[model samples]
Structures are given as structure tokens and as C-alpha cells.
Target: MNATPLVLAVLHPRVALFELGIAAELFGLARPELGVPWYRFETLVAGEAAAQAVGSLRLTSDGDMDAIDRADLIVIPGWSTDAAPPPAELCDALQRADARGARFMSICSGAFLLGHAGLLNGRRATTHWRHCERFAALFPQVRLDPDVLYVDEGRILTAAGSAAGIDAGLHLIAQDYGSAIANRVAQRMLVTPHRDGGQRQFIPAAYPQRRSQRFDAVLAWAEAHIAEPLSVATLARRATMSERSFLRRFQDATGLTPMSWLSQLRIGRARAMLESGDAQLEAIATACGYGSPESLRAAFRREVGLSPAAYRQRFRMRNAPGAAAITPP
Candidate 1:
């Protein structure tokens, strides 16, 4: 990879605004504060510089499909999930780029184009969960893991859905500049520093949207007292429900059990603490509601695929202004 990789976002007709915006935000925007060589970004379109997009929006590209020849990283913001083949010129450009070992990433339905170009053959990939069945049927050669937020198969990457694109982009940043820079970028964007790619994508809500709001106070309370011992009984009492009823309702609302939700919440808090500070393992373990440093290590490794110490060392933001310190409750 070059010190300054050229990132080309390939836009198609009826492209998704959110995914395209994510690409521009992650790569196109300048960040002098990072004090490192950043990506050189450009938009690529086939034929005319202007193309139609979702919401009747018109997008103009900085270059034509030929720009693929120069891009180190090519981003397919999105494509329609239908059987209609992409432009022959676009596929040819992508195939040529792939033959030369240029990296490729697809967001949401954009995997369809990569599959059409024979880029994902015999490689593990993912698309939006809703389109998994269709994607599988369309490209039987590609090994589809529909549950992950994103799949980073070295050169070819695919994000599960709309928001998963953010995770995928941050993963790329981490790969290029280390976790500290990636976490800082995420902080500037006001998003979580990291969500493991192995995390599940399908989180079903069994209750009406309004009813799920009942747990808002409980969630806030739990986050506020994350270092304290918390139990289903105590949570149920706070919500004024029986233990069994609370268990069922919580699962219905959150797609996770009360303890599971709390565990993840604690892990998120721990990750923030690890990224922003140089606190000792014992101190962090205590603040994150762990019984011991060993327990913290076990859980962090299980959830984040890194030990707390390793995570801290890799992601601790140094000398970045506006990086807030996370206070443990």
C-alpha cells in the first residue's frame, strides 16, 4: 500500500446516498490534524461525469472509469440488487484493477457488481443481510457470511448493510494508519471506535417501537452505574416488572438478554476507556465492572479479538485535541 493511497469511489445510477457519503467522509475529507499522509480521493463514473442517484440526486464524478487504473483502493458505494448487468466498461475496468492487485470494497448491494465482475469468486464476502439469499443464489461461487458487519478478505472487502459501511471504512483506516488514528477518526465522526466484524447483523425487534422505549431509563441507569454490580432482579425492580417478565420483555426489545446487553455495554465503555487513556489494567478492569484483570482480558479478547492491554496500546489516541476522556461510572 502506498503512503497516500488513491481512493476512487465508483458511483452508479440510483446509488445510495448514505454509502457514498460515508466513502467521501472516510477518504475524501482532509484531516490535517491526523499528522499523517491521508488518502487521495476522487469519484469515478462511467461515460458521463454526471449520474442519477437515489432521491433523484445528480452526482458528478472527478474522473471517468479510467481512473480505476490509478486507484489503490476502489470503493463501490452501492448498486441495485437486480439481475441487470453493470456497464461492460465498468466491469472491464474493475477486472483489470483486480488483476493488478488493487484493493476493492463494496457497500450494501454493491457486492452485486463485484460478483458480476467475477471478483468475489471463491472468496468469503458479505452483503446486506436482507439480500443474502438473493446474493447467494446470484453468485454461488462466493462464500457468503451474511451475519458479519463486514468481511475483510485482504484485498476484497464487503460491508453487510448501510451503516456497516462505516465499520468497514474504519477498518481500512486502522489497517493503513493503526488503531489510534482510526479511533481518532471515529471520534471526530462521533461513532463507536470499533465494532468487531464478527458481530451479528440481524437484531430482530419483537415489540412495537414505542413499547421498547420503556427500557430507556433502565439502559441509562445501567450505563451510569456500569461499575456497580447489576442483576436482572435489580433491573426488573427499577423497571417495575417481575423478573421473568423483565427477562422476556428485555429480550423482545433488544434482541439480547439483560446480562448480554450489559456485558456489551460494559465492553463498549471499556473500549472507549482503552482508546482515550493510559489507565492500568487493574484500574480499567475495576472501572469496567470486571472481577479482575484476568476477567477483563478474557472478555475483551472474546468480544474485540484483542486483550485490553493490546487494545489500549494499539488504539490510545496521543496528543489529539478534542479527544474526550471517558469517565467510568
Candidate 2:
């Protein structure tokens, strides 16, 4: 995107103030304090109209919704596109823009707009949990996973709820800037750098840190020997502690039990192998100690919220710092 990335946030008569507010806080606001270049924000409304939100709060938007066709990032912050269908023209414009290659994101019910535009078809997506049943029923073709805070399907993304909007926003920032910058923004907002018990290792985060020297050393060793057997009992022995004591200490330090932490490390290794090379699934699974491709796929789906294949397609080679994807224009 030119010098400064253009983030176009969509507003409508039914937009949610909280969702829009978070988007503004993340990308719309100026942050010379960040000491780095940031997004140039804009807003678009269908037909260049102004209307009251929920029929009370007034919102004035400049320019036609078709302007999304030019935005580097298009955000449908929140809209009731399911109950009241978005205009045919607006939906068509979004589809055309997506085809021409722009990243799109939604928060809460805003996913309904992307679903309506057919951008969610065959794509993993989510909305607020309360609306999960309805969203799935309405968009049967969309692969709806109701549990994750957000689903980043390459250029098309969806978040679960109002507060998850903050998670998604911070995630986007981490994807664009580095985790250090993202953490600084989260500090300014007075929230955890990675929320909800932290995300996957493959998911961009503040990077791994050690809480204890001994435990960190054991962990470092285990990561290197991940291809071998790593039973919790074995790890406990390596840490020179009883299984019970080691379990408690490991969880306290990493927010995951010994076994769980090992699983995460294995999954992270598998992801790296998937991204950096063309190793066969069986080879990757065995090298990561998953035993088989099926086992790897199941764990990958549960932890990362997508099959290993899908994750590779979205992230392989394209995931450098500050850029998540590059769809052809």
C-alpha cells in the first residue's frame, strides 16, 4: 500500500459504536508517539448517507461505499447485515473489491456483511457466540467456528464478539508492526499483550519469555529434542522435580501444563516445517512427534482453529513482518 497503509472502516446506520471505536483506536488514530509509520484511516457509507445507529446515535460518513475498492484494508466493524440485508449495490461493491485483492475484516455481527457478500464462503469465520447459530444457519456455506476469538483466513478475517474486537485489532497491529509495537499499544490501552490465556505459538505474540532459569533450560532442551518421546513424567525427571511439582511449576510459568506446553512446542515446530519447506505431512508429523498425519491435523485444528493445510496456504512465504498476505490485484 503506498507509503502509509490505508485502512477504510465502514460505517452504517446500524453500526456498533464499541466495535467502530476499537477500530478507530487501532488504525484510525494518529500515533506519532509510536515512532513508526501508521495507517491512514477513512470511513465509507453506502450512498454517502448519514443515519442514526440503532436509530438513535447519529453517524455521518463521507464518500460512497464503493471507495472500499481502493482501500488496502477494509473493515466492516459492525453491522446487522443478516436481519436487514445490506444494499445489493454495497454487497456487489465489496465482492468486486475483494476480487481485486483487499484485506477485509469484521467484528461481531459485522461478519454478516462479509457473509452476505459471499466472501465467507468456504472460509472459516465467526461472529458473536450468541449469534453463532443464526450466522451458521444463514450462511451455510461458510465454515463457521464459533469458539475462536477471531479467524484470520488470509485476507478475509472475522472476530467473535465486541471485546474480541480488541483482540483482533491488536493482532492486526502485531501482524503489521512487530510484537514490541503491538505490546506498546496494548500497554497504552491498559490491556494484556495477549489475552484469553494467550494464543497459539504460531499466532503472533510478544514472543516467548522465560519465568525461571531451571524451567527455561529444561524447556529449551525439550524443544530441541521434540522429535523424541516427551512424556510429562520424563520432562519432570529432566527438570529434576516430581511429576506433581513439575506440573504445577510448569503451568505457573507458561500458563500450560507440561504436556500441553510440549504439545504447543511440537505444533509450533510442525508449523515452521510446513511454512519453510515442502516436507510431507507424515514426515512433518513424525519429526514433530505427532506419530501420524491424522494426529497432527487434529491437534492443529483444535489449537490453531484450522487444518494444517489451510494454515499453510494462508501464511506460507507471504508471512513476513508487517504483512500477512498479498492477494493478486
Candidate 3:
């Protein structure tokens, strides 16, 4: 059996209900029969004695700042976009906890708390797309990727917005217990187990005015053949345009160049393969159009900041009780 990690969610006043719910659903739910131990989940309030969450949900905490000191994983759920900066005491507590090796994570606007706490400086992060421009301007040191669903930089992880919080929490579960357990939990919740953090946040459902149908057709084709080698010429041919024309139109439509979009798709596929844990690195590489394990490793490291083997080790499924399985490194 695997040991469960302790998870602590710190709630501020006027929290986003959905973000708080994602944390509760993933961590508060007990599933001891899956051969994984139960997570110790607690909701700790930072400021006021009691708070009203979105809807009719009222919340109170068991303790105050002291709770942050004992946490293994400290999560800050969504904070208000217009809210004042987090209190200095809260910021200090967060930094002190991080110095003690407690993993720190944030969802949506909660990322602002992390930024204020100094945990996000010099780290790549994401937040609600609407707030991204401001987030970038406010924190010049943090690299903000507005398109991704989430960014996990070792000890600190940040999610985009709203339901992206679920992806972030499930990712942490996968990291702690292995992909198999995370998948099972996701299955029980009826959610997609993995959406690569790099997926574009918004893709137009309908074509924009004056956009060419040729560009749309080429995009549909590219989505279908993600595992195939794609080049500007190949896409231009599919769209029946000159390479320069196709490049301009594609960028205007999708806000990304052909290769940039293709790389994101390939990385997303690679992440799915790593989470499944059944495929060999070479097989995953070929399936994702990387051609070889070495190529895949280089790409994975560049995009995810970790090797494919290390990713698989962190997210692969573990065998059930009584089954022979090598312990994860």
C-alpha cells in the first residue's frame, strides 16, 4: 500500500466556490480501498474568523496561522482579482512553510497570493487568462504563460482559472500516488484524467470574419494527424496557399505558428502516454512524432522541465495490493 500525503487548503474570504470545491473533491474524498492511504485534508482560514464562500456555503477553520506550519502541501484557492494584496503575516507564513519544504500550490487568482508571497518570482506560472496581462505587469519576474491549463515548477504549481483547478489537483494526485490511482479517482469523478497544461485556453469555435476556409481545413487536418511530421510546406499544401500566406493566416487565426501549435500537441500526447505508463518510451516517441526516445527526452525536458523517465516515475500507475511492482524512485 502507498502512503497518503497530507494536503492543506488555505481559504481566504470571498473564495471562488468552484476552486475550493476542486480541492475538497480531490483531497477530502476518502478512497482507502484503492491500496492508497487516505489524504489528510483540512481547510484553514487565513483572515477573518469565519467566511462565506460562493453560494450558500459557509466555512470556518479548525485553526489559524498555526495550521499552515504543519501542512505537507499548502494550497491557496482563488482570490479576488480586485482584492488588496495578501496580508504580510500570511505571506511570511507561506514563505516560512515553503522554506521547510512544504509544497506550495495555487489555483486561478490564488496565484496572486503566491506571487505576493514571493514563491512565484522567477518561476513560470499561469493564472486566469483575463487577469494574465495584469499579472505579467504586476510581477515582472514571473514568466506568465496565459495559454496553459497549469504550470508545475517542482514545489510550486499554478492553474489557469475556474475548472482548470481540477486539472491541477488531479495532477498533484498523480504525482503523489502514481497515474493509475489518479486515473481511478478521475474515473470516479467522471473527469478527463489529463489535459496537458500547454493546451490553448481559448480556440474559436467559429471562424472569424474574413478568415479563409483553407486555413480552417488545414487546422482540422493537423489535429487529426498530430503524430505525423508536419512542416510549413505540408500545411501550406493542405491549405492550397503559399507557405508565407499560410503562415500568416494560420497565425492570425490561431495566434500560434504551425510548428508552435504542433509542438504543443505533441507534448500533450507525450504527457498522456507518460501518465498511462503502459507504453515504452520509444513507442510513445513514435506515437507522438518525436521519432525516438532520445528526441522525446530532449523535447520533454525542454517543455516540461523533466525527463520522460522521471515524469513516468512520478505519474505512472502502481500495481494493486499483492501484485509484484517495483517501487517508484
Question: Which should have the higher TM-score, number 2 or number 3?
Answer: 3
**Candidate 3 at 126: error in angstroms?**
0.5
Total backbone clashes of model 1? Answer: 0
Give Cα-based local distance difference scores for all models.
0.84, 0.80, 0.80
TM-score of 1: 0.62
**Best by the lDDT measure:** 1
What are the models' TM-scores? 0.62, 0.59, 0.61
Task: Tell me the spans in candidate 3 whose CA falls farther than 4 Å from its real position.
Answer: 1-3, 196-329
* Ranked by TM-score, top first: 1, 3, 2
lDDT (10s digit) by residue, model 1, range 205-322: 1122224788999888887888988999999999999999999999999888998888887787787777777788888889979999899998878766667776777666676588
- Top-TM-score candidate index: 1
- What global local distance difference test value does model 3 have? 0.80
**Per-candidate total of colliding backbone pairs:** 0, 0, 2
